[model samples]
Target: MSNIHVYSEIGKLKKVLLHRPGNEIDGVIPQTMPRHLFDDIPWKKGAQREHDCFADILRKEGAEVVYIEDLFRKSFSQKGSREGFIKKFLDKHGIFNPHLREQLEAYLLCLSPEEMADKIMSGIKKSDLGPKKQEDFSRFFPEEEYEHYYTEPLANLYYTRDPGASIGRGMSFHCMEKLGRNLETVVWQHIFEHHPDFAKDAPMWLSNESHFGIEGGDIAVFSKDVIGIGCGLRTRPEAIEQLAGNILPQDTFKKILVFTIPKDRKFMHLDTVLTMIDHDKFTIHPGIEATLNVFEISLGGSGELVYKDQTDKVEKVLTKALNLDSVQVLRCADGSFIDSEREQWNDGTNTLAIAPGTVVTYSRNEVTNELLRRSGIKVLEMPCGELSRGRGGPRCMSMPLVREDI
Candidate 1:
């Protein structure tokens, strides 16, 4: 059995799951960006090409990359799993159309893995509901609401980092407040519970049932003893409390650092602000490190509460709390106002460390990329002009399952 407990940022990555952008990017119209938690829609073809390059880099690094669609199809193939999932979806959405359910099930069963994934993520259009009935069906069900009632499928499943999170052998799924994103969470639950490749007799923690909302983008493992959580638009404070209570005691982690992000569209997740690069050093946005607040959370004899106020600059607090004599905070852009502000808005600081001092980022953020290169870090840049238009970066593209702790 592989070690499922991921303890550090600099750890050697073994296996990770990534979803390359699909047709869903084309469906994200400009009008729906804010509602769908996106800034702008990207060109689908370009996004896919960039994501493919990112996947190739990870593959070259010898990390096992699992595609979300492939895993979902594998889970669907298991006896009773697809039916059970359909039932759950129906119950959750209050869809009682027996005929529709039967038809949908039959259609789903016939699809290939890639087709199923695309339809499930991008969704089948309501116009594809076939010919209308001749009879006045309204009288049979007076309360029936039928305009575009067929499931408006989740289009952001490619940003696999937003649905759930895992660390140190424990996993917790996010309870999506928006109904559009719920299907992705449902798929995540199915994968963790039934996928033979990952289940491995591992215990699971669900955030949906607990009323604690958290996303993978907001969670980061700095070291075995340290974790950084971002509290902002997506992740709530209660979720952090729940996470600390559940995971800390099991691994005996010394601290969980909480970084409070700006409650705006630009700074959506923690990854937008800080990401580790090497031992005792990190890439950061000055606004996040200098302007935002930080809190130290720990479980004492009574319960979870503030262990210390770390609102000082993130670098200063990190050095003091971790007891490191020196810590380097590389600016996301050279200390210039326009470059820093512009790049940070596009998630420039968000880089996923493949290994110690090695990371991947969006090539479009030239200033941030240059900064990283100057720091002696190997930067594998992927052209994310189309991808970044959707308001996520490299950190939002992948979910790490296992990494060795520093």
Candidate 2:
């Protein structure tokens, strides 16, 4: 009866969570794109169109797609919950100005729940309040500059995968590395804790309160008893160890494989450089293979931690982990150095698998898509000219809530 159940990466996806691009996309101006972790300013309308098509594809594949906004709005229905959430949200973001915080809360409470959700996600500007309030505020602190937003837009919320990962019959909330993305996990945490749909039965294996940074994009549920987490860039070794301590003790999870990937933005998360496409196959960027470092963590007989340094290559390590004799890896752009680099930058390896041998990817990664097809994998391609501006692809934008056991 658990609301969350994701045991394998390539299982038939039953339910998924997504966030359609909204006014938040417009908030990413060129001046702040770097701070927001966006490569370029995305065209708002075009991004929405691409995201809609992506959701449509999942629906066609028999997966039920849920929106983050809808669930969040529903979570606010309980009496006093909306006000409580607003206070916590403002406090967590360092809205310490007493008068400003009070005015903001009163202003937000004036809106309906749906509108409040929209405004919070889109951002509330200082100008939105009347000039009289701004004048009074300036009198209190003359040096404080008038800014565009009192609450910055949650631009990266659309990439639903980063806030948390759904494990076997449970979920793990992440402590995001980037300051801008920290609250993204808070939003989902509130929903999963208050929303009637998930609050009653959903299990939260990890909380987002850790000082050690971890991201959902780096956590991969490879099989029923094994998980692969990347420890570089967005995910830290300490966080992985924390996750291991929590998850390995569960009966459903027996071991965890930690892979050390390049600590670069282009390869920020594990799914950005490698993802499972089929039962025994993975689509990966060849650039990561040369320096791949694998480690194993499991529970000891006396309920303590047992660690090992794995000397085998990624394929060999995966083969042993999944109890398969061999594992196949499909290289991005068929191993062409320059072409692979270009496609990889566009998220060629970040493919989302809805079934055992099928995946969804960006149509812009033509070379990688063709390679997948030739390798006997069904490729469902979606346009990404605008959506790719966020530097994530199909896998990066989705969080599978329920998947059929393989």
lDDT winner = 2
Q: Which candidate's TM-score is highest?
A: 2
TM per prediction? 0.89, 0.96
TM-score of 1: 0.89
Q: Model 2, 236-316: lDDT tens per residue?
A: 988999888887887488999999998899889999988999988999899999988999999999989899999999999
What's the lDDT for residue 299 in model 1? 71
Return the clash pairs for model 1, or none.
5-168, 5-169, 6-168
- Candidate models: Cα lDDT each: 0.75, 0.89
- Model 1: per-residue lDDT, tens digit, 127-181? 5555434453533653333333366556677777788877777777877667667
Supply the global lDDT for candidate 2: 0.89
